[model samples]
Target: MHLAMIGVGYVGLVSGACFAEAGQTVICMDVDPQKIEGLRRGEIPIYEPGLEDFVRRNVAAGRLSFTTDLNDAVDRSQVIFICVGTPSREDGSADLHYVDEVARGIGRTMDAYKVIVNKSTVPVGTARRVRRLVSKELARRGLDLEFDVVSNPEFLREGSALHDFMQPDRTVVGVESAKARQLMAELYRYWTEKKFPLYFMDVASAEMTKYAANAFLATKITFMNEIANLCALSGANIDQVRVGIGSDSRIGDRFLFPGLGYGGSCFPKDVKALIYMGKTMGYNFNILEATNLVNQAQRHRFIFTIGSFFDHQLDGKTLALWGLAFKPNTDDIREAPALTVMERLLDLGADLRVYDPVAMLEVQKHYENYPYPERIVYAPTPEAALEGADALVINTEWDVFRQFDVSRLKNLLKAPVVFDGRNIYDPAQMKQAGIHYFYIGKPIY
Candidate 1:
């Protein structure tokens, strides 16, 4: 199959690489010539695990290419995948301008029958809207071309996107016509050998499925966070509560760990979009509203815990921050809880020395234009962050931080104080090391 991926973002790049690896000829199109040129020169724009290897391998095999010319890409492909971004608008609605532009471009350029697949996470009626835009463009050209728009949302996790794409548990495809369904099935026939299930549903349901799944996962994380907070007040341990509750067949152990609230690209945006969707329809999604509230409050509660430890006297404190990425194994810092903590600490006039495996450059770039960029110091190593600092705060649960020498940690810091946001360390070990440890959902010692 010949495929044209409209936008070269995370979803488009990963999907295009995986599809090319599956023996499909793919051209990943983007508006930025610089990004396309960078891809051509083996320079990947994003830091995703295993993505650079995939792009380079497929490009070397002549199965995948990158381009800024949308018309050329559209004219040569039988399947056009709308993999553009739908960032949240101010009102929490999905900003579909990019998707609409791609649809209009496809309608204007596609000379033959093509299968248009919506692989981006979008609102329920976006496929219908894209169909109308494409039809309108075709009418303007006075050309009657047949194209089928299929809603096929992706469910790839960020850190493990390549594996998820290559080994998806299930694929949900929404189609209106039998022809579209058959074409989609043929496109996904490669997965049938792996015995991965394919679900066929209406377009609206498929769109709703993506939002519902993320919202539910976000809700689960929020619920666990609430329970963790309550456990802290009642002198209970969340680790035990999590194990006891997750052992139930009904409640699995995924996304149940108590940590800083859910962030990154999908969860925060999808939850807000769903809430906004409900408001638009004259319905109130009360649970989701609370979920959003709880997630936001989790960050503040963590900040307050840190502040209370110092008796609200944070001025001139040199703190060692362990992580900056929203989660481990990726360099994405969007809506990262670490940033919230860093900002609040800076506001309280504390000097920060931060370290992350791969996200330091990103955070430094972000602070370049800040008012007090000099207040934020970059550390060469995690141990370097602890040097000459008053205390340590573990913001992200990176593997290196998880298995660090606790005894050395107690020796390195000016004060043997630790604030663990991700609850990565064992409390008993901290106690044995004679280190002051504070973590989420348990007694502080």
Candidate 2:
């Protein structure tokens, strides 16, 4: 299978690498000349677990190649996958300006019958819009060529993108033609050797599935956060409650982590986009509406807890903050709860020393815009982040943080007070270290 993947961003690169690893010949194209050159030099732009090795091995095997010439990629491949970004607009709808540009370029450059796969997470009816635009472009060029647009929504969780792509829950292909379905199946047959099923559906349903998956996960996280908040006032332990509820078989313990909140490229934007899409058709999505509200409130409430813990006198206090990315194993910090906490703490006049395993440069890029750069320090290690700090706050639940030596931590900080936003540590163990531990949904000790 010869496939041309447009846009070498997160989705495009991951899909291209995985497809090449599956023994398909893949040509990944990007408009950014610098990014394409980086790829040509075997340099991956994003920090995804297992991706650097995956790209290296495939490129070594001569199965994967990179280019900036979109026309060449389009002309050479039978299938062109549009894997561009659809960032959220100010109005909460998906901003499709990039997608529209790519669609027009593909229309102008497409030579023969090609299957254009919408691999990006897009709104409903975008396939039809692409189809109409492509037809108009072809008509403008006075050429009549057949092309099939397929909506192939991605359900990849960051930090576990390689696994998600290799062993997908299921492959949803929204196609209108039998020929297109057959071509897509041939391209993806290697994945089915492990028995991952392929689901063929209508275009609209396929687009809806991506939003529905992310929105449901966001709702789950927000629901747990709400329960955690209620437990805090009632003097209850959310860990025990989470276990009790999870054992019911109806409720799962996957996204039920009483963390700061959900973030990254998917949940926050997709949920809002779904709400905006529904509102356009005069449909009110009460569930997702409440979900978004609760999620945002959780971040602020966590910040308030830290302030109230210190009697609201956060001035001149140096706080040790761990975890910059929304979750872990990825450097993406979009809408991360840790950043929200950092901002609020700074506003209240507290200096911050932060560390993440991989998100250092990302956090620095954002924090550089702040007026007081001296107030924030990027530590080289987790222990360095704790030095000279009044209290330690854990935001992202990375596995390494959970396994830190508690007794040594007691000896390192200015004070023995620890605020755990992810509830990663055992309160009993923290107490044994002569540290006052505060976690979500537990009695503040």
Candidate 3:
């Protein structure tokens, strides 16, 4: 199959590479010339784990390519995957201009029958909207070309996107016609042959599935955080509660970990988008609304706990912050709880020495326009971040942070105080090491 992936961002790039690795000829198209040129030279734009190697390997094998010209990609490919970003607007609705532009370009450039797949996370009616835009463009060009707009949303996690793409639990495809269904089945035959489930549904259902899945996961995380907070007040251990409930077969545990709430590219944006979507339909997603409020409050609550420790006086405190990328194994800081903590702490007049494996550069860029960028120092290592700091604040729960030498941490910090937002450390262990440890869902030790 010849595939053209429009908009070579995270989803587009990962999907295109994975499809190419599956033996399809994939040409990834993007508007940015520099990004396309970088891909040509084996330089990947995003910091997804194993993505660069996957892209480079596929390019070396001649199964993958990059192009800045959309027309060429559309003309040469039999399958056009609209994988552009549907960024959330201030109104919480998905901004679909990029998807619209790609659909119009495809309508203008496609010369024969093509299977146009919507792989981007969009609203329920977006697939139909794309179909109408394509039809309108074809009418303007006075060409009666047949094309099928299929909704095939991606469910790839950021850190383990390659694995998720290749080994999805199930694939949901929304097709309008039997022909479109057959084409999509053929495209995913590799996975289907291996018994990976491929579910076919209506376009609207498929679109709603993505939003529903993300919103539910966000709600689950928020619910867990709420439970953790209540546990803290009632002297209950969230870990024991989590294990107790997680062992239930009916409520299989995932996303039940108590943390600084859910923050990443998908959950927060999708939850907000779902809320806005409900409002547009004259329906209220009360649980989701509360979920959003709770998620945001979770971050503030952690910040307040930190402030209360200092008697609300945080002026001139040097703190060591570990972890910056929303989660570990990726450099994506969008909507990260760490950023919220850093900004709030800085507002409280504290100096921070932060360190992350790969997200330091991204955080530095994020703080470029801040009023006082010099207040936050990017440390070279975790130990360096702890040097002369009054307390240690754990944000991202990277594996390196878990393997830290507790004695060394106690020795390095000016004060043996630790605020663990991710609950990565054990309270008993901290107490044994003679370190003051404060974590989520437990009494401070």
Candidate 4:
């Protein structure tokens, strides 16, 4: 199969690489010449685990290519994938300008019968909207061309995107015609070899599935956070509670660990988009609204815990912080809880020495123009981050932070104190090391 993936961002590039690896000829198209040129020169823009290797291997095999000319790709391919971004707007609805532009471009460029696939996260009616836009363009050209618009949303995690793409839980495809369905089946026949379930539904249902999945996961995380907070106030340990509850077959142990909060490109935006979708339908999604509120408050409460430990004298203190990306293994920092903690601590006039395995350069570039850039210090190593610091704060539960030797803290820090946001450390182990430890949903020790 020959396919053109429009907008070579995270979704497009990863999907294209996977398809090429699966023996399909894929052309990844983007509007930015610089990005396309960089890809052609084997420069990957984002930091996704195993992505660079996959891209390089496939590109060398001649199954993958990069281009800026959408017309050329459309003319050569039998399938066109709209893999553009749908960022949230101020009104909480998705800003579909990029999707709209790509749809119009496809309509104008496609020369033959093509399967138009919506691989981006979009609203329910976006498939029909893309169909209409393409039809209008064909009408303008006085060319009667048969085409099918299919909704095939992506369900990928940032850190393990390659794994998720290769081994998906399920593949949901929305289609209206047998022609479109057959083409989709052929395109994804490789997955069925592994016996991964493939579901085909109506366009609206498929679009709703993506939003519902993200919103539900976000709700689960928020619910656990709320339980963690209650456990803290009632002198109960949340770790025990989480294990007890998660052992139930009905409630599995996923997203149950208490942490700062949910972040990244999907959860926050999808929850808001669903809430707004309910409002437009004359219904109130109060649970999701509460979920959003709880997620935002968790971070603030974590900062409060750190401040209360110091008797509110955080000014002029040097705090060693770990984790900058929203989650580990990916450098995506959008709405990262670690950044929220850093902002609050900086606002309280505390100097920060931060370290992350992959996101330090991203954070440095993002905050380079800030008014108090000098207040933020980038550490080359976790131990370096703890050097001369009053305390250590762990935000993201990266493997390096999880496996750190607690006894070494006594030699590196001015005081052996720790604030664990992700609950990565053992309270008893810290106590044995004579280090003061504070974590969510547990009494300080």
For candidate 1, the TM-score is 0.98
Instruction: Give the number of colliding residue pairs in candidate 3.
Output: 0
lDDT ranking from best candidate downward: 4, 3, 1, 2
TM-scores for every candidate against the unseen true structure: 0.98, 0.98, 0.98, 0.98
Off by over 4 Å in 4: none
Per-residue error (Å), model 1, residue 267: 0.4
- Number of colliding residue pairs in model 2: 0
Ten contiguous residues with the weakest lDDT in model 3: 436-445
lDDT of 3 at 209: 97
Backbone clash pairs for candidate 4 read none
lDDT per residue, candidate 3, 1-445, as tens digits? 9999999988999999999989999999999999999999999888998998899899999999999999999988989999988888998888899999999988888789999999999999998899999999999999988889999999999889999999999999999999999989999999999899999999999999999998988898899999999999988899999999999988778888898998988898899899999999999999999999999999999999899999878898999999999999899999999999999999898999999999999999988998887788899999999999999999998999999888787789999999999998888889999998888897432
Per-candidate Cα lDDT values, in order, are 0.92, 0.91, 0.92, 0.93
- What's the lDDT for candidate 1? 0.92
After superposition, candidate 2 runs with Cα above 4 Å error: none
Better of 3 and 4 by lDDT: 4
Per-residue lDDT for 92-136 in model 4, tens only?
899889988988888887879999999999988999999999989
lDDT of 1 by residue, 1-445 (tens): 8999999988999999999998899999999999999999999888889999999999999999999999999988988999988889998888899999999999888899998999999988989999999999999999988889999999998888899999998999999999999988888899977798999999999999999999999999999999999899888899999999999889998888998888888899999999999999998999999999999999999988888888879888899999999999888898889999999999888899999999999999888898977788899999999998989998899999998989898789999999899999899999999998988897542
Q: Which window of 10 residues has the lowest lDDT sum in candidate 2?
A: 436-445
Q: What is the lDDT, from 0 to 100, of the residue 296 in candidate 3?
A: 99
Per-residue error (Å), model 1, residue 184: 1.1
What does the lDDT come to for candidate 2? 0.91
